[model samples]
Target: MLYDAIRFQAFHQDMRIAMIGVKGVPAAMTTGGGIERHVEQLAPRLAGLGHEVTVYVRHYANPRGTKRWNGCTLVTLPTIRRKYLEAIVHVFLSTLHALRQKYDIIHYHGVGPSTLSWIPRVFAPRCRVVITFHSRDQFHEKWNIIARAYLAWGEWTAVRFPHATIAVSHVIQQFCIKLFGVKPFFIPNGVEIPSASIGSDRMKTLGLEPGRYFLGLGRLIPHKAFDDAIRAFRNVPTAMSLAIAGAPGYDMRYAEELYALAELDPRVRLLGFRTGEDLQQLLAHCYAYVCPSRSEGLSIAVLEAMSHGKVVLMSNIPENLELIDHSGMSYEVGNIQDLTRLFTFAAREPALLRERGERARHIVKLHFSWDSIVRQTDSVYESLKA
Candidate 1:
């Protein structure tokens, strides 16, 4: 029987909660990027609320087996392979394992591996199931026509099964309504300001002179539009360098294209991946941060830049526009000319950059603080019990 803390406060006080996804919690606790960061932060907070939390992860490359951290348990299941195909197998096996365990609530992330949702509806009908759509995968240009259709179908199924769904941004919520006719609750990603020393000496170590470069940080994927940022940097009158930092995971060919482009121009530097203080240091000394993603569901990278108090020039997508609509910040999603103009403008007026950067930090502190986000998420969990 499931524990009902509010109903039987004295007798059954601990609620068992399970978080389901290809990779979650402990596996995400240390290394992965944004989604991993979400699980790493959220699971511990939920556990702190006196809920017994279990994060289900795919046994891809993880060799740690099962472990406990932050008062939460991580359960890994065997899968077929380490690639995308393995995600499907992982969902099926994880769901089967979850069904055997007694959980009151099941929170699933991403829609790609729809098998997880499909099983929960059939096998764990009594459990309150919540799904969070991190982003619309179909918008990525890397997907072929057939792959796009397949992902769309998976998203449709996953959204339809959940009792309530979460969309990380208003743009994503609208996309859910349009594509799946599901009105998911919106909960934007949040960030915590790093300590002052995090990224202080990044410029010195990278051999970059102060105020001589701009920064672009994210996964090296085509959809991120790194090429567009490079083209815009060419138009700047000052001898400005652009630092591209991220891991090239999805498309090596596209990464090769970016590398070739950088080779032609000495001004562009591609740093494969930087973590810890290195990433912070790079952001700390950057003249400005640029985000040229063609589509985004509230970019964590953009938020990180804002947390560092750097002026950001982002694409005109609704996700970015929702956060930044200031004087110095301007939009250029598809038009290279507009991006060039924005870069030129930033180079000409240094004071405007500082002003915009300060404003960006202020806005983030007001709306995107992690404390407020954890409270909202806690409310969501409490709602399930009610």
Candidate 2:
């Protein structure tokens, strides 16, 4: 009954598609960050294109909610809350639940969840299995030896079991080909061009001014290197402040370290977890967006910043480089001294910075449109169907 109206609209083409592995939909509407956002944009658009879409979200993420998102159905399943066990356990239960759904496509996100893609392949042999390799999860420093080993196995399963695989970046696609000899469809993540501008009232509330602060947005994980931005900001001899917006993602110790470091500098504002309009406001109004991450799987935050017409400063990792197209600045990955120099340069050159921001926006709009991404993804599903 929840999606009754949508069901009627979509009755013409009931191509049942199941999206697994993400916490929830409407990325900015949910807490799962990038992967959630990826599904958020893709699922509803697919539904609009006349497919029956169902996104499996964890129970804790939804708690009590309607089964409908945009036009896609949400199936909330329960899972353990522990850091290491949560994803694997929820993915296991979701895969079991999906086995009975008789879907045309079972699409899994993240390498961690794709480890279980083999289940649907074995049980529901008729269902097409697809996994989107968001990143090399095992590269994250938060995981221990055993955890890394398990994730590496998950990556192997991702390449081996899926009927089709999607790589969010060219770097990831090449990695898959080299390791598994399997070519994945390259479907870059998409960003929306803002139609209307919201006034800076929200920025005012946060004691932030438009085009005055440098923004760092993403999870407060070690690999993200928010600390590098904080330290670099400390040395920049300018009145501009550094606003870091994100929650600690299963790395409490690292989070605590960042907070303590931020306290040492009066200019650093550790605004935890800004999403939706709050996130948009910061991205729209910032002087420059800094991504000091040592690792990435084609960062959504960076693309979003570029979409908002902000200059992006990132670590020189291959994934981050792929997004810029020579429109942004990069430092040596994990080199704080180099980041400090970049920050100082960004502070000094305002006209040049604005020029870069314009180029950044142009590149993202040209290369990463949501409509194009969804259509390409739909083609993958169709290929499997044939």
Candidate 3:
């Protein structure tokens, strides 16, 4: 088991819960990004809280056909597996299947999956429906106008239709209130502070030297702006390498663009789709972590990086700023020159990086624990009962 063994909390009444919308968990077993990472950490903790948790996973994402993981029941289901159709299609089937079960809570993870949240509300009148607004997906650059409009409706239904709505960020919480007149329970994403340092065997395999390379991690989508990170790193006059870890998300073209940009400089290495011990080593040993994403709700990656005691150089987007509380080094969004300066600074200034990194990790240790987040989510579920 990758988690610490905590005895079941007997104080809270055990509730039957079904988690929908993420690709799968453990995130190690799936090609999970943010939502998968969220569910991966969440489901097991909820189970340890004395709740019976069932996660609906797409078969395409988890091919091994595992039956159980981390004290939670894994119900693997089939999906269409297309770029646009996979998540929604899997969610539609999962909702129908989950409604038949005697669950106390049916929680949906993202705005795209929350479109079918009404099914549980109408059919399973006794079961509480909870939707987490993980991101404002309608604003993401990958969607066509038709898909964007549908996502807009999904966002509307997410807040209004659910029995209780949870927003991962204050920015998202406020957006729901201003646009939909609904106030959601604010629960930021959680991270586990790694108790022990991982060995550098994985790092050596990837040609990454400890404290020598900067790390950028996330899926290779257009909105993530990995090209910006590559372009910026190319301008830095140093031997320090840039190690970017992620796979092509919804579009392959964007990955091609990143590859083309990386070809210009040998210092950039795109290590694809790392998770588990491999990923932890990257976070634990890097000089700093980079998140060049253009959109987010609350980034698990950023929190995880901070939890590993690494300074995060994120784009100065509202969500990123909210997570770091202005404690991190921020570059102007999509400004290669500005990001280049930060990259240059990372090469030049090790002492300041260590100080900021320590403070950032301290903040995560004090504020964002999975145990606390599970309790807050349980409170929301209990509120639905009344």
Candidate 4:
């Protein structure tokens, strides 16, 4: 009573934050991907900075209405999940739920769900809406004509509606500027650089011998061009085997084609999804990590490989170029011949592989650490609050 009679003071503190996307924390963690990894890292780190964070996710597998983990609250909303296109419906419902919450800032990921952005303008006009355009997914040849048009429209809406936009790579920023007339701030993905460790024991558990394999890590999608890696590896020295690590989800047909392509060839092994220590072990001990993707937006798999100090042979997309140039190591996109030559070169000169791996590690340390990325993202959040 004495203190209350003395004085009254206002307090300025960190803002309440909401991250809106299709996936929640534990689901995202269990199913590893770029967007999931981004949320898993950024949300908790933002919470640690004294900001109240609640992530809004689409209700897919979660029976629970809400859950909490690692100091972050996860709110799931009801939505349809018939096809991939239904993600928009899910995101829209999730955004509506987010708008009902007392959040100072709302951050949305991806451009598939255009209607989701309207929530901030319609329901919570005062709250700042920040959208991170993960990638321009329609560019891939996999999409049919109508689907591409729909996605393009969604992208347009996503760029136009947000208070601010974030592009995950320089390539993506340029694409958004060119296609949607939106100039987005660039924030590349982050990776945790690993300490030196012999991953032979872990590899042995996966039925692979130490130092006897090359690794390809990513979803078995058509654009990833896993078949190109297999064709290229035909030119590699006999001793080295190729291990493709990723789940078959969007492109089961592509997976079937890959299996058919490598039917009799024991050199290529499709080791479907491997996470945790299994993935880390593969990255640590592989002769080299190959990313044969025709298109990318700062690949998390490549960054993971670099983090483990592995030599990377990637396609010559601008995103890959941004990470590693042609001088030390790289191959032209969709060029089986160039990839074959690079593979042969890596097999013949083992010392060069080690040298390039060290260089890759150095690059990751300088540019891709999670701490630096989190700080950069925090600065972005601060800018919105201001």
lDDT of 3 at 229: 93
Window of ten residues with lowest summed lDDT in model 1: 22-31
Residue-wise C-alpha lDDT for candidate 3, range 207-318, written one tens digit per residue = 8899899998888888888899999998899998999998887678889999988889999999988887888899888989999989888999899999888889999999
Q: Can you write out model 4's per-residue Cα lDDT over 1-386, one digit (the tens) per residue? A: 56642431122247788887646665333334678778888888778867798887766545666588678888877666554555677677777777778688888888776536877877898898888888777776577787778778868877788888888899889988898787988888988877676456777667677777889987777888999999888766677789998877554798899998777578888888887778778888888888898877788888888877778888888888888743236888999999999888888878877877778888888887787787677667777776
- Which regions of candidate 4 fall more than 4 Å away from where they truly are? 1-12, 26-31, 60-66, 178-181, 325-328
Give model 3's clash tally. Answer: 0
List the candidates' TM-scores in order.
Answer: 0.89, 0.95, 0.95, 0.90
In TM-score terms, candidate 1 sits at: 0.89
lDDT (0 to 1) per candidate: 0.77, 0.88, 0.88, 0.77
Per-structure clash totals for the candidates: 2, 0, 0, 0
**lDDT ranking, best first:** 2, 3, 4, 1
Candidate 4: count the clashes: 0
147-250 per-residue lDDT for model 2 (tens digits):
99999998888889999999999999999899889889999999998755666789878878888999998888999999888887788889999999988887
lDDT of 3: 0.88
In candidate 1, the residue pairs with backbone N, CA or C atoms under 3 Å apart (3 or more residues apart, or in different chains) clash, namely 199-280, 199-281
Candidate 1 lDDT tens digits, 1-386:
24544543453345788887646554222235567667777788778867898887766535677578789888878776544566667767777888878788788877775535867777877787888788777788888887788778867866787777888888878878897677888888887786775535567667676677889987788899999988777767778889998877555888888898888778899988887667778887889999999977777888888888888988888888877858237665878889988888888888878888888888888888876776677667667767
What are the runs in model 1 whose C-alpha is more than 4 Å off?
Answer: 1-14, 22-31, 80-83, 178-181, 197-199
